[model samples]
Target: MGYEGEEIEGYYCLLIAILGNFDASEARFLYEYGPDHPVCQKILKKRPPPVNLAKMSKEEINQCMYRLFEEGYSKRSIADLFSCYPSTVNRRLTIGKKQDAEKKMEERRNQNNAQTDRCPEELCRGKP
Candidate 1:
């Protein structure tokens, strides 16, 4: 009964995959694919809509942006989620490319170091 965030993300990915619109494993779907297909309305019922942004600091916002960017979201879309202009998103995203896991963790640590109130001192030392 206690599903984690990664599990929820996997379920979303499975929903996207189940549309059966992606390229087939054997490369046949592309040749036989059409621009239009039937869609099930209920597939997105569990998806949560974007909520109003609370008093998120610059570091907090950047943390979210980095995570989403690493997960392959477009700057414009990430801006929309944050209710800001794409140009702002571009400015905050200082890195030019998707980062590897180790790099991402280092960046997160560096960011969290300045946010001691948000992330406790224990978390800084890697203790739960």
Candidate 2:
């Protein structure tokens, strides 16, 4: 069946999710839009529960947090996904980003140290 009306409702869902002080959970949608809402209907259609973040590795959590942040999920929502405090999300993200930055810097330093692998003769000739 065509879901033109439901498709339009997606925007309302997005607005509610973004503007509401709510977590990215089924309860949030059910509470705001009611259980009959298309969004909630889709959610309820799935019997399986979402994966618990506790079973995931720290790296996985970090990557998930980063991906959600890039896709515009609020920090609070991300924390809710993991059932953690927002401060925990912020702290973990900060540390993860710092490590990524350091890794990039280290890579750059290694590239610089390579110096195009030139010998003294090549350096004197100014070929690189």
Task: Summarize candidate 1's per-residue lDDT along 8-105 as a digit string, tens digits.
Answer: 75555555455542223212322224223223322222222454468777666776677677666678667767778998888777633333455778
Candidate 2 residue-wise lDDT, 80-125, digit = tens: 6678899998988887777677878999999888886769798899
Alpha-carbon deviation at 100 in model 2, angstroms: 1.4
In candidate 1, how many Å is residue 23 off? 23
For model 2, state the Cα shift of residue 58 in Å: 2.3
Instruction: Tell me each candidate's TM-score.
Output: 0.37, 0.48
User: Which 10-residue span in candidate 1 carries the lowest summed lDDT?
Assistant: 22-31
Q: Highest TM-score among the candidates is held by which one?
A: 2
Whole-structure CA lDDT of model 2: 0.70
Q: TM-score for model 2?
A: 0.48
Residue 56, candidate 1: C-alpha displacement in angstroms:
1.9
Per-residue lDDT, model 2, residue 1, is 44
**RMSD per model, one decimal:** 16.2, 10.1
Q: Top model by lDDT, which number? A: 2
